[model samples]
Target: MTAERGVHKPNLLVLVGPTAVGKTRLSIEIAKSCSCEIISGDSMQVYRGMDIGTAKITPEEMQGIPHHLIDVLDPEESFSVAYFQKVCRSLIPEIASRGRIPFIVGGTGLYVESVCYEFQFTEAGADEAFRQEQLRFSEQFGPEALHAKLTEIDPETAAKLHPNDQRRIIRALEVYHLTGTTLSRQLESQTKASPYNLCIIGLTMDRQLLYNRIEARIDEMVQQGLVQEVKSLLERGCSRSLVSMQGLGYKEIAEHLLDGLPLEDAIMKLKRDTRRFAKRQLSWFRHMKDIHWIDVTRGENFPDHLADIRAIIAGKFGIPLEYNYKH
Candidate 1:
């Protein structure tokens, strides 16, 4: 759409991929070239002091490009898709107002899609008593039992969510209890039209190569003091039960530290879980429409890959190969 200054600005330029797929560096380069600000769509990166496990980009690595939504929450605080959608919808226009593109960059599929489709959440707020009831039921009967309850009521939504994803399971149940409607059905009724002109780019590599990258990245995180990072968070009063600590790396490490599991086993579990997470991410993106996939494995040279991506950006979104960075 046209901005007040008569410049055309796409509502958003989204770059999404599985974890450890080189989204960070490429996003930085794209942001630099397009004069855009980066807004992280990652759920884990929103928590402060969750650097190593989340693979958060350091200030130096950001190369002076503005980024939003990272380090914005405490580990104990709760965040939701509704909140993410609200903040991003507001930020996109503001970024465009300053004559800069807004780039939604991360692997959090739900967060990205909520903004892209402009989901209208129902008015039913959290039912604290019901939530605590579900929490206690899960503690007493186990997560599967709790998930089974959801399956009986809303099998379609439960089919998409993992049994161990307690927060979402509880949320889905809460929505059902409060509104007498399944979350999936409610979402299906909302309008899917995005207010902005959206350009979505997805990155992928060979399956074997992607798995290797996930393994290597986990090893790198260990070298980067991931255990110590989790320990520091715990020492600072973050609990294992906090949703932030349930992230791939942090949760596995927490199991090691708290449940007396061996460190090596925890590391192995972390690697396996990350691989599964990447696969799930890919599955989510595949179901989305209008993604222009860029196969990074097709080229060995980083510069060549960057050039191809730039060409796609220019051709699809009308962004130039070079633009001044907004200070």
Candidate 2:
């Protein structure tokens, strides 16, 4: 890591944006130019069988860039922001020690923020019986009903999470149950300080165009056998209730395959939900500090955007990047 004056921390590069906003391609380009080892900030990409739906990066697409935290867990295994924070915290220094900048890239806002800002979560113990009870309540009264409970206890957290995001909702309830203190309150108490010299970039574009891109991506996923992928997971005895199954594509497709909904309807729901999810992701990242935002609406001019981002990184870290404008 090149030492910036007065900044003793190791360098960390983060590229974050809403889904379907071109983070993956841009991140790869930046990493190529910056000598970065990327650690995925995406939450769902960890599950092993969730390839096409989660849009897991292909080996060919990585182009010799070593990536961490992708496809590391079985579908049954649970992953959380706290766990992501712990693992990513360790990876930063290790990657830098190898003389590569640690680049975190994806749209999972809270998970990325926790690592960047060194967020401290409450040490609330889990209650198996309580968890089961909450699960039963959600099952009986529906997820929205359970979310209403969280709304009463911690409205800030509930507002951030989708009603169908039962795992985090239940965890928030559990924290409240254990500590008599709200989860949001604990998060608010965090220092929001980083242990790394950070260079954060956010990509955005026109909303309708982004939504169109999202729908197009979903169409591509369907052609890539997304339904069959979810079916395979289900046939393997992976429950629809698993956190892995709760991801946007998996949830909608599972409903279609198992609940007899039409595939077209499922695709429509997936598209709409994904658009909203992207909006939420943007909302979350915009609230973060020090993000150099770049509008990539004119995707035909990607070289220009890439040059702009290169400049941002070069300016942020006081390092030179090789670029040829006429690519």
TM-score of each: 0.90, 0.96
Model 1: lowest-lDDT 10 consecutive positions: 1-10
Query: Number of clashes in model 2?
Result: 0
lDDT of each residue in 67-106, candidate 1, tens digit only: 9999999998988898899999789989988988899999
- lDDT tens string, model 2, 240-308? 768898899998999999999999999998998898899999999999998999999999989989999
Best by TM-score: 2
lDDT of 2 at 36: 92
